[model samples]
Target chain A: MGIQEQYRSEAAALLSSGEVKLVIGFGEGSTADRRRPLFARTPEEAQKFVLDAACIANLSTYLVTEGLLSDGKKVAVFLKPDGIRSVNILISEAQLKPDQVVILGYAIDKAEITALEGRNISDFSLGEEIRSHTPPPHILQEAERIEEMNPAERFEFWKAHFSKCIKCYACRQVCPMCYCRRCIVDVNQPQWVSTSSHTLGNFEWNIVRAFHLAGRCAACGACDRACPVNIPLRLVNYRMGKEVIDAFDYCAGENSSQKPVLASFKQDDPETFIL
Target chain B: MSEPFEPKIVAFVCTYCTYAGADLAGTSRLKYAPNVRIVRLPCTGRISPMFILKALQKGADTVLVSGCHPGDCHFTAGNYHARRRWTVFRALLAFTGIPEERIRFSWVSAAEGAKFAEMINEITEQTRKLGPFTQYQELQKVIETQSTY
Candidate 1:
């Protein structure tokens, strides 16, 4: 059976047995080209579960929104590798609990699963898919090149791009990791980011949003995908991801037990930049 | 529009090291740019990324974070944590197009009064060449106008 068929059956079995209150997965959208997030409450509904390249929505975002894991019921989530990482991070951040959610992982290929399990991927096809599916080349290249530029050039490049933003907040709304009950930008009293779509407010909003996700973002590409104007928002997150890894050898969501890089301290961490 | 530009520099100093170092600089009668306004925190670890952006939004042309040298932190590892956080924070700042020189991190022990003075001199001189942080100011204005609509 195909992976999708197996996942559907397993989810159905779990739901029918009352093992989980809800099984969050993907379903065929009204159109063939699209897929939508699915909340399977019954074994019969599990037939709607589908897994494909179009299943790109990070369903974990709904863990809070749809109240799937609420009411003190165990919720089961079907996670792709990226989704697994996001789930792990969310769990570590106390956003979700392990017993509260059960993860059913889906690998595009078996060898990819092996690699994730800390085993070598001997299958060339699986390896190729995983390699080709890594973060886009332009993001990696730009991240490296940006580090080489002097501060002024770096500032100019970002300002030029951010000036084009319309303050849609699509990036903020769509990010699975941005689950704050009230975002700083939305707070009116102190007025963190201006409520307008002007250049200064736009830039500040983008910067603040990105910084807020620092060391917590799983580099899931949801923000970039959700942007209406196609801002390369992941570039900011990816750049921070690289720095976190380089400076502390830390990767978000990789280990459920590890403390987040920004939230905790190590006596031996590098402080060469300190005065 | 040839107004004399005075860069607004926000310096986040850890109370243990750089904050004490700045006090020493003051007590020793050392001279440095008066452009910087210091925000003293218990440790570098307490300096959140929000504070940096807040400083920028409030019209700081540059933001500097100073703390104890690695392994020299009075809290034993506060500066180490700060370093890791700033490493990522700095990269995010750069990616957002904030000028790199506008944000910096340094280690200055309580005894390093001369280094603190030199650091300020360097940041002030570099910021002078880079000019004011107009991009953020311009955005702030737009945000203000939109809210009125």
Candidate 2:
């Protein structure tokens, strides 16, 4: 049997035996090249699970749905390394309990699908690998290209891209870390970020979003994919990520037990920028 | 001749240290640049990154964030935490193409009144040299002229 069949049987068994209350995987999407999240509550539903290279969405996001784990039953979800990293982050942030999630992990490389060696979060050694794994060359190259520009050119560069933002906030919607009950943009007390027609406010919205994710981004590329305007969201994320690593030697979601870089601080952490 | 441009500078200071430092500067009768308008907060940790951006949006030509030294935070670790935040936030600002020169950070204790006074004068002079910040404003005008609004 193929790997897909193997995972399907595994999912079916998990559901049938009541080992897990739900199996979240991919079903056939609208296009053959696409995959949609499939939630299997019963053994028959588990058979429809599609484990393939196209299953890219970080399914851990669904696990954060309000009250899903309130009753304390286990839910199994198929996850790539990035999705697993998201789980680690959520667990670290106290958003989800580690015992409540059972991750069925996979990886896709160059259109090839392969199973990652893990079930429980602790079963995998992802910290070292994620820290050492260099991001793709294009993101680095683009970041460098932007850095080479003068301040004026750089400002113009971002202004052109951000103005295209319709403020639809699909980027915020797709992110797992963005599980705020009330997002800052939605708060109107001071209304620092206006809700409408202020283009500068739109820029501020994107900047604030990127700022909030500085040391916390799971690097799942969800925001970049979700963006309708193709604003190089990853480029900004990569730059901020690089800053935390360079300044504090910190990597997000690298370890489940690791302290969040911003939340905790060392007295000796670099402050050269602080005059 | 037309009046010279006086760049608007907003300084966000921790009341425990920098604000006290500013108070000392005044009490000492030491003169500093009058260009700065200071907003006092409880601690440096209270200086949100949004405060800086909002200052810029509200027509400040530049912003200065000052707090206690690393170990001297009135809350014991507030400045240390604030230091880390500014490190990340300042980089994010630069990456988004905000001129790094436009945002400044410093350490000021209650004893550093002269330092505070001199630093404000220096910032005021430097901002005067840099002239008005029109980058965000120009973009604001871009959105303002659009018929979509």
Candidate 3:
């Protein structure tokens, strides 16, 4: 059988044997080229799980659906290396219990799909793999080009993109790391971030969004793809991700037990910028 | 429109060190620029990045965050933690095209009153040369005029 069929049968067995209460995977999307999240609870439903190169929404997001694991039951979910990284970070952040998450890990290269040889979060050792993983070359070139621009030009470039924001927050909804009970943008008493779709609010919202995910982001690129206006949201995440590594030697989601960089610190962290 | 421009500088200082240092500057009769408005908190760690953005949103041309030196933090590693946070925050600001020069970070102990006064004067001078932060001020202006709609 093909990799997709193999995983489908595996998913079905997990449900039939009561090993997992839910199997989160990809189903057919509205378009042929697009795939949407599919949650399978029964054995029959598991058969509908579709595994392919187009199945790239990072299904680990569904695992944090607020109280899904409160009962302490296992939930199997389809995951790529990025999704596995998200799980590691989530487990490290105390957002999920590793024992309760069964990772149906897979990796996609080009147009081919292949199953990874891991069923548990700890079975995979991905620290070296994650540290070497770079974003697409064009993304790197664009980031470099942005860095070379004068502050005024950079400001205008981002302002132009942010102006198109309609405050839809499709990026926020799709991020597994964004599983906050109350996001900073939703706070009203102090109103740290403006709520309107205007440029001012958009800047604050986007900044806060990127700031919150600094070293915790798995670089899943979900936010970039989910953005309705195509704000190149991942660029800022990439920048912050790079900053954490270059400045502090901290890579997010390298392992399940790593301490979050911002939460922990050494006295010797570089402070040359301070006067 | 031709009036002399005085840039507004918001200084967020930790109470134990930087705030006390500013007090020393006052007691010593050290005259610094009057452009700064100081907001004192318990520790540098307590000063969130949001405070810096808020200062800009409210029309401040620059922000100064001063705290105890790394080893001298009253709460012992608070400055260290704040140091890490600001390093990350500074990069985020720079990456998003915000003028990194507008936000300053420094260590000010209670004994360094002269340094406090001199730093304030220097920042006021630099901000004066840079002029009002119309880039951010203009963003706030849109909110005021368009909020009615």
- What's the lDDT for all of these models? 0.76, 0.88, 0.91
Q: Write the per-residue lDDT of candidate 2 for residues B1-149, one digit (tens) a residue.
A: 97989999999999999999999999999999999999999999998998998899888999999999888988999888888999999888887889898999999999999999999999999999999888876666667676342
What is the fraction of true interface contacts found in candidate 1?
A: 0.78
| Model 2: CA > 4 A from native | B1-3, B146-149
Q: lDDT rank, highest first?
A: 3, 2, 1
Question: How many angstroms is residue B93 displaced in model 3 relative to the true structure, after the best TM-score fit?
Answer: 0.9
Provide the lDDT at B71 for model 3. Answer: 95
The count of backbone overlaps in candidate 3 is 0
**How much does each candidate deviate from the true structure in C-alpha RMSD?**
4.8, 1.5, 1.9
Better of 1 and 3 by DockQ: 3
CAPRI-wise, candidate 2 is: medium
Scoring the B chain of model 2 against the true B chain gives a TM-score of 0.94
lDDT of 2 at A121: 89
Model 3 stretches astray by more than 4 angstroms = B141-149
* Clashing pairs for predicted structure model 1, backbone only: A151-B100, A155-B97, A199-B139, A200-B139, A201-B139, A274-B106, A274-B107, A275-B106, A275-B107, A275-B108
- DockQ of all models, two decimals each: 0.54, 0.74, 0.61
TM-score of 1: 0.84
What is the Cα-based lDDT of residue B115 in candidate 2? 97
